[model samples]
Target chain A: MSIPARTTEVIGILGGMGPAATADFYAKLVSITPGASDQDHLRTVIWSDPTIPDRTEALLGKGPDPTPWLLDGGRVLREAGATVIAIPCNTAHAFVPRIADHVGLPIVHMIGEVARYLTSLSPRIHTVGLLATAGTVRAGLYQEWLGRSGIHLVLPDNASQDHEVMTAIRKVKAGTRDDTTTALLTRAARRLTARGAQAVIAGCTEIPLGLSADAVDVPLVDPALILARALVSRAGADRTAR
Target chain B: MSIPARTTEVIGILGGMGPAATADFYAKLVSITPGASDQDHLRTVIWSDPTIPDRTEALLGKGPDPTPWLLDGGRVLREAGATVIAIPCNTAHAFVPRIADHVGLPIVHMIGEVARYLTSLSPRIHTVGLLATAGTVRAGLYQEWLGRSGIHLVLPDNASQDHEVMTAIRKVKAGTRDDTTTALLTRAARRLTARGAQAVIAGCTEIPLGLSADAVDVPLVDPALILARALVSRAGADRTAR
Candidate 1:
């Protein structure tokens, strides 16, 4: 990754889905950036409010809305010198467009990055197996964004989609990670792979902790990686290294 | 490990002492809590601001002061519903007391927790080995706090102290887990254990990731772990099962 003028624009992190994912994004941001000293890397302003109501639960009306907190963070980042914004949480994207509209900063879209990666990786690849929350799927975030990128998206079969993919996300949000989650995700990944998916997107950041690159025989692309790579690029770090 | 009839008060975490510690703290809070569900656990609010200036550099005038960010988070948590406040970053403790004064909430002291743990684990514990940032040490955060807790604290011999621990922290901050760091910390741990430390507290959150409990062959007490246990106790989770 080439350094542009030794520093780039400051990056803003709209996190708080859970502290772990937020931390992971910050590490990945520093990992890909070129810096002889820590100060050389781009400055960051992180609003990690883990107290935000559950995205899925709220979407399902099990809890209060997270929009107020989401909007608060967006405005905070904008005031903190964050020229570009990125959210590490997949489910939180449900509120991104709303927050982006009000907050007024360029939020590097994670879903778009995933779609763009798929298109750049394979000319023949048609459909992808997406493993995300019920809210993300129901909201059609990935489907709608991928549509614009010209990539066909394949979701988990209806029978198991909610119970499997969504359950995995809730388990993580609730701080639960065990074999039950592993079994559920693996079955869905296989189901999507079998249907027509050339690759699987571990769309949720928490899913990767349970499912790794080797878990499934098919290609597993982490959307967070795409977001981090894009952040590094926006921060003026070379993208080629990624 | 006993639960009162009433619930434990909520904790607001002002973090971003890099992201790993914040994630570890949240996980630890869950691990130590006696909860069966999300509500079963105490409510938490975390604000991780990694952009806050480097403590060591800031104190020495090599960088900007982070006191502003620290104060901002404290106020945010106070307004948001954090009954008590704590910072996961050891170095940040230098400014915590000042921040605590303005926040209007009881700031659970990380160094105080460490001192209490040392005293309880081994009454005879003296000449203890602490691995934290140069600023934390220079500020005598532990020395001052431990004195009140009634323990003698011995720091790493200056030559080995400053470079290795700070270097290890930077590597983890940079997301590198190379063997050089592994060996450096391993040897540092050995020297500290030999210096009559009943146990070595990986005072720096980043240090524990590189130096595992197994590598040094001494009882390793991680501040992050201590903070988590304290958080659990504060959360007032049910302890009937235990």
Candidate 2:
């Protein structure tokens, strides 16, 4: 990890992707940063409004439009003095484009960063399997990013897609990881591997609850972690050309 | 829950006790409210700046002063449109008195509401145990409030009090909990019951992780719930008031 320049970067995390994950990111900051104490970690501003319409629900039309609430989140973090902003929710990245224009601060894109990370992997793998909500998959976000780098992005077949992946996402949101949920996720992971996916992007943060690195043999890419590294970089973790 | 008057009463949550609970409260509004969509839940302004020095650390001299952070939390919420603010963090309630004057919004007291709940529990109850951080017990905030009602507030003996409870708080902040941590908390709860307490006010919001109502024979009061109820009332959950 590079030491971000000493130029006080007040990072803004647009969180509330299940409240626990937001906390996890902050905790990760503490763990990863070269800090002498809590104060030494990067100064951060968090606008964790979970009230925004559920991203998958909005995308599926099972819930209301998320544009206004998301806009509120962006404007909020912007008003709060975020030098740069990040949204921890994987699916919410869908609406970020609409809201980004309203906020003054530039957003460090999570999907873009993860896509870039996969392309920059050791030995540079050519393919990745995506285990995320159908909303994210249907939008072709990962596929679009990977396509730019001549990398192939794969998804589970229709039979295995919604039932396994979406169910795991719901279970995590409900704070459940019972044996049944665990088996469902394991089965989903197997299906992705069956599809010849070289690596699986734990695209939805929730899936990581069940499919840890030990649970599956394939390389797992956590979008949130990639986002954090991007944050550390944006915070001036390295002396590099922007 | 009382129906709030027509005026959009501003509710400021003086948070950063740890950022998770603050976000949890915000998410709960979106969940439990009668809104068909995102806009229906009460509009909330949260200041979850975790850089605020730890109230416990600050008060105990284990860390720097958190007064500035607490004051900043208050000022931000007031400027954001909160008519009255409720601090979700129990420890930070120590400075509510000072923060009230600094901001235009009236500060809702989490400790006061917990005291009221205890009072309504039974006519014979005069003593209640507080299982909170050393900072909270040292500050005498709750003891002072109960003293006004001619009631005694009991605290754990020195043996039962120390880093155990605070460590549990940090664990919750660290965003990881295992069965062993839960067992450690249960041991602490049993000790609180042995101290001749009728009820244990989960004095620190983090303590609820370690000890629950079932862990001890006595009733357990969660200060966060009291704060939540107070917020619901302010938002006009009471139809009679309407």
Candidate 3:
């Protein structure tokens, strides 16, 4: 991680796959950074364009591709002097490979980071449940990465995915975080754990908003929080590298 | 408000007077926006440079000038395709005048919006108390704007400003929002209300984080929330101007 003294790491958030999630991620980043003052935190540039076509819809072939929008956001960040980019959306990672090389800045692979995090845990998580958009499941985002780390993923059935998981996610996105939404997510987690999941991954960014870690019987992991910590750790590493 | 159909408004947030305040402002903005999904939210670019020197220290002649950093941030946002800029930090407003014209984008005045908001209230507040950084107080950021609206401003004496208000703000910035911080702010607000203040403005962005509306007997005004509403209103107006 050694670098020149002048190389300051600025984190670029390519966000707004949904705006709330982006805000949540940034808040977490600020909260987790080891700082006594403002100057102790990382320098960040955030480009949040909510109009970027839906990533899940794109993956399902029901909407236009978001590659150009993601690339434009990356370009905006790089041009604005961001040294590294972090996209808070989990589903949006499906298109990350398409824009990563073209964006010219190193895009932190959130899913890969999540995989590393899960494996790094004490008494290493052998089996995890995923509650994410069908598009992420269709794209095998968690499956591909978690498989490499020797972690098994348990997902909801199609009926439960539509009726319980997605409805709850949509309700959260639309600004409803009531008992019903939490119940829906909790029920989905129960079903996954019933199928032998040791822990649950709040795979969708919106899920963490509605589902608390204590809601389910097993530990509920938040990828966004993990990604925020990873970003903070990387920024610190880059800061002192010489 | 009339404009061509193709014209779109993008919000540029010049933040990171402390990173948490910036994150809080964005969260409030997202929470308050009238939206059903991601596309319904506004497009925003945030440049949060925490390394920007302390505004209050600069105003007190104890630190270096922050105008260069402010100008640099404005340029970054404008170049990132932001059509209008909104600075979340109240103390940083002192330098807004220096960078407004040079940034090549309209900077929304947060303090002015707060004055207008107070004047527009049904009860018609005549005198409002302020809880802000010493820099903002010294710069007369709120005084000039509130005075123009016929609103009398009640400020803390030297003792309260240092021992209670500024300490509370600093505690919140250092990520400590305990009962002690809240009590300090509450005591400050009580002293102002004792002086016949109708409402207390959370003049500093950090004030709202530590002191809730119910903590004070008088209405607690959050300038950050007001600023978020103003940005949303202006964005919506610009959006439908055709």
In TM-score terms, candidate 2 sits at 0.77
Which order, best to worst by DockQ?
A: 3, 1, 2
Docking class for model 2 is: incorrect
Write the residue-wise lDDT of candidate 2 on B96-189 in tens digits.
7766678777777888888777777665677777878888988898898877776687787766676466666666665564665566666776
lDDT leader: 3
Q: Rate the local accuracy (lDDT) of all candidates.
A: 0.74, 0.69, 0.89
Residue B158 in candidate 3, Cα distance off native in Å? 1.5
Per-residue lDDT of model 2, residues A1-242, tens digit only: 12232556777777666544565565554445443323344656666554566788778878777777667667666676568888877888888778777878888888999878887778878878888888888777788888898888788887777788877777666555577777877788878778788888888867766677766688888888788878877777434343
lDDT of candidate 2 at residue A77, scale 0 to 100: 65
Poorest stretch of ten by lDDT in candidate 2 chain B: B30-39
B87 Cα displacement, candidate 3 (Å): 0.4
All candidates: TM-score? 0.82, 0.77, 0.95
Report clash pairs, candidate 3. none
For every candidate, the chain B TM-score is 0.90, 0.88, 0.94
lDDT of 2 at B133: 82
State the iRMSD of every prediction, in order shown: 6.8, 6.6, 3.6
Evaluate model 3: give its lDDT. 0.89
